[model samples]
Target: MTGTPRPRTVLLTGASGVVGRSILREPTALRLLAATHSAPAPEADGRRIRCDLTADRLGLEKEEYTALAGEVDAVIHSAGLTEWGLPAERYRPINIEGTRRVIEFARHAGATVHFMSTAFVAALAETAPVALSEGNMCRNYISSKWEAERLLRDSGIPHTVFRPTNLVGDSATGWTSKGQIVQLMSDWICRGRAPFLPAHAGIRMDFVPQDLLSKAVLRAIEQDVSEGEFWVTYGAEAMDMDASLRVLAKHAAYLGRDLTIPPVVDPDTLTAEQLAGLRPMVRNYVAVLRDVSEVTRCSGGVLPSSMPELRTRFGVPLVDDATAYLRSLEYASAHLS
Candidate 1:
């Protein structure tokens, strides 16, 4: 009888990223081929390879590519352009075509693929579930991710998709590589520039801690799970917009910044002049807030259930929203400010 296959070597793209670094820290049996583009190779227990996700053969030399294909057992594709507000053209090559290349590489390597997607792919749904599941609508950044998912699904390779929501700082230390949208809002609020934001009591903002997401990715890899899409988000436990604002307000107060918490108002109620007065970044954020508010309102704040089985099996800790927000705020204050 055939015994179970041995633990496989994993080609982990975006190894210099927050999620990648966190994954590297996990105690796993599988070997890692840590890949980065321009970021310095991480000083971790893994083989570091400089790779460009958008390049032919991932920017590897002929021999390197051949060696990778021969030895790699799986690929965790986590690299992509995640910035919002950029044109579709800017995202297409990196987010879309880059994913295509990853899929191609995985195919050649005969490797299982673990794709990193986004929960916002569900933002385009007309009816939002209390917990978002696989198969949803898309637009803008979401659109690119959705297309990437499609490419993976059709790639004929064994793959699992992870759609994580707004990843915050680490759950314990609050360190983060990228300053996300929430950080931007916090920065604006602390500066007293954003005195108002559009929201309602029912508006839920999902913020998954970076560590939690990383652990989930590691678990998926370690378990060699290749099934349906996994929604790597807090789901119903997502903090309400008002509650999030309160947390930010508390941090602002601690920083000796005396300012009124921004009141949530309907975006349409604001005059064009008022919108124009806001910074371009904040203005774009407002537009997104408005869209999310509309979708949440229509869907009655429902989302897909959280992945309890994954958590239970992997011993992943539940994220505390209050603590996470505070940590993120602290990190942003230290770095962004």
Candidate 2:
């Protein structure tokens, strides 16, 4: 019988992101070559390479980039512009072309690729369904990510695509940097701007904590799954936006006696002028609240179904949403404002 292959090497981009940080915490036998466009990170175990993905050669010449690429067995492309309000040109350079560069580097280096994508790629408009899956069409950021995915697939490099939902983690510890979405939610829950009614409540956003997302990506790396798509999430049943908010409320109550998170508010009740004058904190809270509520109301109930292949084939563990949600809240409260 043949023995299992030795642990392979990995070149991980976005070493500081919500999912990327989680992946870095666990001890893996693989040789990790972690790269980031951000400022140099504190010294750690892995081989660290600093490169801006938007650069023509990803800030490395063909020979140097190829040399570094040849040293790794797989590439997990997590670096990209994730801002919703970013211009298309801005997003295209990093998210699109940068992805293409990863694919090229992986292919030339004869390494496998893991593409970090978003479920938001399923739709951009409010009419898009909330519970999108692999088969769903691309819209908004989903559209650009879909374009990136297509390029990777066409590159003929062996690849695994991960489409994750909202990410939850602690920001104070630098475990998870607060994204725009999370920041908005934090504002609402901390400042008491969320609505009270079910209809007016934020949409049922599917969320996966950093740990789960990291695990799924690790699983994809360890196993030679078919080159296709997979959704890394806590599962459909776990994505209860309102219930998650309640947990946030509980956390606030625990942190400060004066803090009281309100129930969901009806959008029709708030005048434009009233919402306009809100502090940055309050505005973010209202925006996310309204956005989620409006989208969820339009999309109907339930998150996208889980991909059983991720578990039955690769043995990835399922995470408890309430537990993850609460942990995230506690961590954020202790660290970030």
Per-prediction TM-score, please?
A: 0.87, 0.81
lDDT (C-alpha, whole model) for all candidates? 0.76, 0.66
Q: Give the RMSD in angstroms, all C-alphas superposed, for model 2.
A: 4.7
Model 1 over residues 214-321: C-alpha lDDT tens digits?
787677777768766777776677778767878877888888888787678975487889888878977876766666555454445544545575589656787687
Q: Judged by lDDT against the true structure, how good is candidate 1?
A: 0.76
Clashing pairs in 2: 121-142, 195-263, 195-264, 195-265, 196-263, 196-264, 196-265, 203-292
Best by TM-score: 1
Candidate 2 global TM-score:
0.81
What would the per-residue lDDT of candidate 2 be over residues 204-225, giving only the tens digit for each residue? 6566666666766777677754
Q: Candidate 2, after superposition: displacement of residue 160 in Å?
A: 1.4
The candidate maximizing lDDT is 1
lDDT of residue 209 for candidate 1: 78
